[model samples]
Structures are given as C-alpha cells and as structure tokens.
Target chain A: MKIVLSATGPGFEAAVDERFGRCPYFLYIDSETLEIEATDNPGEKASGGAGIVAAQAVADKDVKAVLTGHIGPNAHEVLSKAGIKMFTDVTGKVREAVESFKSGNLKESTGPTVAGHFGKGPRV
Target chain B: MIISIASGKGGTGKTLVATSLALSLSENHRVQLLDCDVEEPNAHIFLKPIFDKRETASIPVPVVDEEKCTHCGECSRVCVYNALAVLKTAVMTFPELCHGCGACAYLCPEKAINEELRGIGVIEIGRSGSVDFVHGVLNVGEAMAPPVIRQVKKHIFSDGISIIDASPGTSCPVIEAVKGSDYCLLVTDPTPFGLNDLALAVEAVRSLQIPCGVIINRSDVNDSQIEAYCDRENIPMLMKIPLDIEIAKLYSRGIPLVLGISEWKDRFIDLFEDICACVKQEAI
Candidate 1:
C-alpha cells in the first residue's frame, strides 16, 4: 500500500506541513517496503482551489491514505468520495507520523479541520 | 459616458463621491448609479431606491450525471480552475472555484456533465429621485463577485451618464467593474497607505489602457506625497475634498454631502464638468 504526506521539506526527517493544499512538498511512501519519494506539490501556488487540485493529484496517484496536519472541506470531500482514509492532526517529523500510522496510532479525521482559504496568509 | 469611481484603499470615500456625483448630475442628465461593490454594497443605504425590479444573478456550474459518467477524468483534466475531481468511482465538483467557463461540460468525454445556473446574488434596479439605481447583493460565503458586478453593469444608461461605484482593491471584481468605462475617477486619500494602494489601482487602470483621474479625499490630513505622485504620473487631480468633520458627520448619517450641504452640490457638478473635459481631451 502507498500513502502520501504533506511535508515542509524533502524527506522523512522533514516536518509535516500544516496546510495540505499549499504545502511545498509531498512525500510518497510505500507502506510495506518503507521506500520514500519526494516531489513538489502541483497545487502549491494555485491562484484558487488549491485543495481541489491537490486532492486530484493525490487521487491520481492511487494512494490508499493521506497523512497531513490539516485538511480543508474541498479536499476532505474529494478524499472522502475517493474512499481514501485521511489521517490528520499530524505533527513532528514525517518519519514519526508514518510510524504512528503503521502502528495504527493515528486517528482518521471525520471531516475538514478548517475553512476554505485558511492557508492564504497575509500578503507581502 | 460611463464613468466608474474606484479606490484601491477601502474607506477612502468612493461611495460618498459616487452618490454625490450621481445625485448632482441627474438634474440635467439621465444619470445611472451602479453599486458594483457587491459584497458590501452601501450606496443603497444612501440612495434608498424604490427597487422596482429584482432578479437573481447566477453563474453556470457543472452537474454530472453519475449514470452516464465513465469516471474517465476528462472533465477534470480540462478544468483549469480545479473545479472538478474525478476519482475511480466518483466525481466531485467545487462550484465556488468554478469560473463558469463551461469547459468541463463541453469536454466531458461521455457527455455526462450538464451546466446548471447557480445563484450567487441578486440584482436590484429602481429609481432614487432623478437617478436610476442598480446594485448587486452577493450571497454570503460566495467568493465570486465578478458575475454579479457584470449583471449590474448591464443596466448602464448608455444614452446618458452612468456612474459606477466599484469595490476597493485591484482584484478581478474591480477589473470587471471598471472595464470599458469612458473615464475612471480614482478616489484616494493623502496617507501613505492610500498612496501605495492608489499606485496599484492606477496600474490596474493603465493596464486596461483606460484614461483615469484622481480625487483626493481628506486632502489635508497627511503629507502631500500623493499629490507629488499624481504630478509625476501626469494624471490629473480632478478635485479635492478637505478633511471636514461636518462631511464625516453627514456620511455617518447616510446623508450625501450634496444633500446635507447645498453648497457642495455645485462642487460635485464642477467635478463632473472636469471629468467631461478630461474625457474630451483623451478623445483628441
């Protein structure tokens, strides 16, 4: 089985990003072999609907689950409809979150944690 | 001629200037006022139109037929706004993100998608004294304002003068309101924040290649750098309104300046004349 984690940096040692839609990096992992691959999130700089595009990209990857710090209603709906279980409120390093997921320590989120456009911070 | 009043900075008195100008000019011209600031439309509070006509404003959003959908992801691939998502067994639509471009339904491989009109707001049209009034009330939680703004602009008095009150900021909705105006009157303040946003508003207008002028509201409150910038840009400073407590008091009471102070009516008329002169010069 494969899973994806929204991360701030490239590897398992990196911290999990609080925003799933606009996270800079995504770490795709094979649950059994523990192999990891990191890539840029395609929806990172979307003008709008970052969650929609991010959800689409994840669904295309055929991932069984998603591990992230937070999820929005749009992304949550897409993930739920895709039948992909979402484990949220994740913190600390990606490796630790993965370990917790593998050990069945993480709780599946029933719904979105925040509102839309919550990831958009103050403009420069 | 169609003239739009805009300000990059909020609370710079765009509505105050718009309402006064529309009221003052209606005596001689068949003037129309469009409150294009759909999200927080306030001109209605001042004009208090009779609202003879009201209709729902909507945009086309896609609705998919699950039975016909093959879950091929074609509609998702064609949507640039990320309004659609196709999973293996299901498809999702985010109507708020949809621009209503109809690309999704047009490109759906199995012809499963159908376009539906989703209500975003309501457009109201009526009479206020001699002026024709139109404004849009955007539904709460709706992110799209351009469609509603466009609906209001459709009521423009083409034979006479049309004065549009646009929303603050240099965003898509502002562009939709200010586009195709014969002239743009940019209301701004003398403060630093005002000047910064005014520059952005100016860029937005210039990008559209529309001729614009500036109106300095509360001109005596701060440094005169905004004047300096206007001079540097060669954009005419059409009028100036000093920081007067009486004017603020009138505005707070929803009384337009021209109505509260009869003496100010001539000033607004003069301002309209100056705008006409500027538009004439640009035509040359």
Candidate 2:
C-alpha cells in the first residue's frame, strides 16, 4: 500500500508539515520498498477549497492512506468517499511517521482533524 | 444614475456615504438604496427600513443523475472550482464551492446532470420614507455573496437614482456590486493602507470603464497624500468629511450623520450633484 505524507521539504528526512492542504510538499511513500517521491502541493496557493483540491490530488495518485497533521472537513469527505483511509495528527519526520504507520502507532482519524483553513498563514 | 459607493478597505464609511446620499437625494429626487454588502450588511442599522418584502436568493448547482452517469470525469474536469469529483463508481458534488457557472450540466456527455437551486441568502425590500431600501443578508458560512448582491440589485428602481453600498475590497463581491454603475464613489482615508486599497479599487473601476470619484472620510486625521494621489490620477475628489467624535458617537448609536447633524444633509446633496457632473462629463 502506498501512503501520502504532507511534508515540509522534498525527502523522507524532512519534517512532517502540520498543514495538510497548504503544506509546500508531499511525500508519496511506498510501504513495501520504503521508496519516497516528493511533489509540490498545488493546493497551497488556492484562494479557497484547498483541502478538497489537495484531497483530489492524493486520490488521483491512488494512495491507500494519507498521513498528515490535520485533514479538513471537505478533504475528509472526499478521501472517505474515495475509500482512502486517513491517519491524522501525525508529527515529526516523514521517515518516522511512515515507521509509526507500519507499526500501527499512528492514530487512524475517523473524521477531519482540523477546521477549514487551519494553519493557513498568520492568524489575524 | 446608478452610483456605487465602494471602498478598498473596510470601515472607511462606504455605508455612511451611501445611506446619507440616498437620504439626502430622496428629499427632492426619487432614490433607491441597495446595500450589496451581503456578508455583513449594516446599512439597515442606520436606514432602519421596515422590511416588508423578503425574497430568497439561490444559485443553480449541478445535481448528477447517478443512473445515467458513466463516471467519465468530464464534469469534474470542466469545473474550475473543484466542486465536482468523479470517483470510481460515484460522482460527488460540493455545492458550497460551486459558482453556478452551469458548465458541468451543460457539458455532461451522458446527459445525466441537472441543476437545482441552492439558497444562499435573502433579499429584503422596504421603504425608509421615500427612499426604497433593499439589502441582502447572506447565510452564515456561505462563501458566495455576488449572487445575493445581484438579487438585491434586481429590485433597483430605474426611474430614480440608485446608490449601491458595495462591500470593501477589490474582490469578486465588490466587482459584482460596483460594475455597470454610472459612477463609482470610492471611499478612503489618507493612510497608506487606505491609499493602497484605493488604488486597487480605482484600477478595478477603470477596468470596468466606469467613471469614479473619491470621498475622503476622516480627511483631517491623516496626511493629504490621498488628495495628491487623486490629483495625479485625474480622478475627481468629490467630498471630504472630517473625522468627528460627534459623528462617531452617532454612528455607534446607529444614527446616520445626515440625520443627526441635519446640516450635513445638504452636503450629501452637494456630493450627489458632483457625482452627476462627473458622470455627465464622462458621457460627453
């Protein structure tokens, strides 16, 4: 099974970004071989519905699960309907997060972890 | 004439100018006031129109007929808003994100899409004496305001002057409210933030090819750089209402300055006259 991790940078050593939709990069990690490929998140700069757009991107990659710090309501709905399991409230490095997932140490989120537009820029 | 009172920044007296102008004009001329700031409409707080007519505003969002849908993903591809998603076996529709552009239903090859109206807000119409008052109240959490603003504008009385109270900023809702007006009155202060937003609002108005004038609210509080900018742009500086503690107190009490000060009523009339002159000059 392949899992997508919202990352702060382009490698498995990079820290896991807390922002699911607006995170700068995402790591597509292969569960069996532990290979990692990173891609820029297009939804980072979206004016609205960033979560939904980000969910669509991950769903298109045919990932079985998403590992992120938070998933918004819209994104949760999309990924849930697509039959992709979400593991949220994830922290630390991408490599550690993947290891946690493999050992079932990470929590499987039943619903959205954060509200819409969470961690988007500085707060007013 | 349709005169839109717009501001680049919020709390710069767009409603103050619009309501006072409408009240002043209604003394001698037929006037209609449209509060197009659906997100946080406050014009009724001052105008206090006894709303007698209420109508709901809706947008037509696509509803997929699953029986006929082939899951081709065409509808999802055409939607710019990402409101539609075609999954393995079903199509998901997010009505809140939809702009109601009708591209999804129109381009569905399987002929399985139909539109259903989703209520976004309500338009309330009544009379504040002779001035017809119309305003839109957007449903809480509804991201779309332009649709409700358009619905409020539909009730505009063409035989009289229509003063549109536009929401702040140069975004979609502001554009929807200010576009197609005979003249746009941009409200601003003399601060840097005010100047920057004023420039944006001016550009938006000019891009729409509408004549625009400036109203410097709290003119005495800051430097005169806004005046310099207006002169450089060759846009008329219509009026300057200085910041006054009395005016602020009255506004806090939901009382229009024109109603509280009485003499300022004539000032608003002058403002309207200047707008007419600017519009006439542009016509020529």
Best by TM-score: 1
Which lDDT tens digits does candidate 2 get at residues B1-284?
79999989899999999989998889899999999999999999999899899998999999999999999889988888888888778788999999999999999999999999999999999989888999999999999999999899898876889999999999999999999899999999888999999999999999999999999998895647898898899988888888889999999999998999999998998888888888888889
Model 1, position B218: C-alpha lDDT score: 88
Candidate 2: misplaced stretches above 4 Å? Answer: A35-37, A122-124, B221-223
True C-alpha contacts between chains kept, each model in order: 0.92, 0.38
| CA displacement after TM-score superposition, residue A66 of candidate 2 (Å) | 2.3
| lDDT minimum window of 10 residues, candidate 1 chain B | B219-228
In candidate 1 the C-alpha lDDT for residue B204 amounts to 99
Model 1 CA lDDT for position A65: 97
The CAPRI classification for model 1 reads as high
Prediction-by-prediction clash tally = 0, 0
**DockQ of each candidate's interface versus the true one?**
0.83, 0.52
lDDT tens digits, residues A21-119, model 2? Answer: 889898999988998889988778876777877888888889999999999998899999999999988999998999999999989999888888795
Cα-based RMSD of the predictions, in order?
Answer: 2.2, 2.5
Per-residue lDDT of model 1, residues B173-222, tens digit only: 99999999989999999988999999999999999988999999988947
TM per prediction: 0.93, 0.91
